[model samples]
Target: MRRNTTFLSAAALAVTLALPVQAQDAPDAATVLARVGEAEITLGHALALREQLPEQFLSVPDTTLFPAIVEQLIEQELLHQHKADDLTRRQRSMLDNEVRNFTANAALSEVAIAAASDEAIAAAYEAFAAEFGQGEPETEYNAAHILVQSEAEIEEVAAELDGGRPFDEVARERSIDGSAQSGGDLGWFGEGVMIPAFEAAVMELEPGEVSPPIETQFGWHIVRLIDRRDAQVPPLEEVREDLSGEIQREAARAFVEELRAAAEVENLATDMDPSILGQRELLDD
Candidate 1:
């Protein structure tokens, strides 16, 4: 579903807002641009509306955005003046929810922005480095396989290996798998990359050792172990983006928990039939 749907269509405004824009000194948002009857539409209204737009629409040039946004505000004002007092209960409830959601998000955005400051990021990175460095070096496996339709086909493939035919050579000649073109070589992978049955088979084999026919949902299989190595811990700069995300989440959660502790929130629907939530007619004014 579309996110944060607005009164004006994003696609419609995109075309209208695409007119050429030249650079110029910016004006104050409070500057009045239009009067819808007695109601004034200011640059602030246009700017706020533009800010409310989805990210995909934000790249539209501002000079082009000004007239179109003012026009939209005038239209909105005309509509509201015509019948805003006549809004049905559903429309009013939806508008209330939209305002609540937008304002709450604005508040949480402040917390997240503060949480991801340079000092916070540095502290988070230090903790991550300590915890990450404490773990045993991770192991990786390089393996290959021949996938076949049934037990008989896999056995025939395995028997060819017993006769000293190269695994890759037999794979190309008889294997139905896609990797047959590359000598059935599934290249380097870390632990947990393969399905459980396949991974279990690989771990039991050393380099150059091929397995007996193993069954999985796709069909039967035999895996050959190729090589193994340990993965190194990545440097801080490489993982900074992820670290900052974790910092933001932790701070938001802590702030929310603190608020919850001091609040008197309670659910009043404890005894209501949950299925009543689907009765759309109940929303009628």
Candidate 2:
């Protein structure tokens, strides 16, 4: 969803989306919640109508909510009583401004949403798939190895492994990687998840085979391939909303850039020091 920057400075209020109880068995004042001259409207009736407001409006604080709503209700009632046959010039100007702002925002939003249509999303998916080749892909392993700064230590661990000692036990007692506590299990991942050299060593082995001192940036690795699988595409339903929002944002950004290109905006102080502009701050109130 778009950021609600316009409403950030608006008054705070608690919103309630519930119908009020009738005063049939209670006080008379409750039955006459709204009084405009001789006319009267019940609190219960207004509360019942409150459900029609937007969810955000229903969540405002009562302190700001009640007065604003009361004023609006009174105005609406008065306007109904004395309906204008035609709008005044000022009214037309105000309405024109409102319409212009609304149309601009609406058009931008509609363009963004339309860019996320199923066909567009499907094309994006196809592009990603193409990069991975047209066959079922292999799952790559992701693991970190810690190498001690000694060769003898590597040999001692290799011997323990040859003697059927648990791999995790050897790693905890010897391997310097932070993952030693977790048996050096680097978590599940797809192919190409590791550096090319490191990945090559792991891919060569069977699930239980430990490598013979393969070296990398950190040091030598006693590699183990715990698991492997054919990679698969996730179901579209699981990512539909994510894909839609991403597409919408891209569309909006492109529209903004296009507008910028067409406009002839001038920077009067373009040659002035950049620091001058950076120090200016607007007062909130």
Candidate 3:
């Protein structure tokens, strides 16, 4: 059996094939490419379809892609013209949803563009650095502690350490906290991380000196300061992308809030079953 194939007009295919080599200097998008019935397919339509092609298709040569894409657009135009007056309820509903989604995206793009301008991004970066950057090198502490359920347990652990038993050995045998297995090593941390009382005790201890039992909500603690160092802030370039994203999100949120405040909205479904959201069949008709 000989299978039949629908192909584009020979002249149209020749013109499309030549487009790849001259793509950089192609005519204006308004130039007409083909016509299906009364509907016209323009260069813009072909370019838009090309943009939406899957990533796998991107590596295809432009010469090969140009005619194929144009043919696809012509086929789609023909189908659209044939079905224009016979759309099903589902198709109409989907078109309405797409219109809403694209409109919302267009508005968000405007907000993002204004928010990400060079001047706006620079100002945001300045503000973020002033608020969060360390103006001077800040101190970090390396410390360890033995946590116990009762004051008596902490006292016993402290006494063993004073009597020349190793701090890690004492912690492994007596501490109840999660770090006990790792010799109660808290790793390096800055101030404001531990509870107020615990931090205060840690700050007061000299390296190699153990504290008397300190009380916190978690339990009693014997802390040993191991070392300390000053940490510097990262360069602005290292964090610019994060700052720009934060500014864009804040701007979009503010824009949406302004629109919401000026609009009249009502919750007509206040009494409706919330579980109705799980019923995809509701969109059927």
TM-score of 3: 0.59
Q: What is the C-alpha local distance difference test score of each model?
A: 0.79, 0.66, 0.79
* Per-residue lDDT over 216-266 for candidate 1, one digit per residue giving the tens place of the 0 to 100 score: 987888888888878655677888899889888888899989989999999
Tens-place lDDT digits, model 3, residues 165-243: 9999888888898999999899888888989998999889888888889999999999999988875444667777887
Model 2 segments more than 4 A misplaced: 1-139, 142-149, 234-249, 266-285
What shift in Å separates residue 12 of candidate 3 from its native position after superposition?
A: 14
Clash number for model 3?
A: 0
Rank ordering of all candidates by TM-score, starting from the highest: 1, 3, 2
Residue 264: error of model 2 in Å? Answer: 2.6
**Reference-based TM-score, model 2:** 0.44
**Native-to-model Cα distance after best TM-score fit, residue 77 in candidate 2, in Å:** 36
Q: TM-score for each prediction?
A: 0.69, 0.44, 0.59
**Regarding TM-score, does 2 or 3 come out ahead?**
3
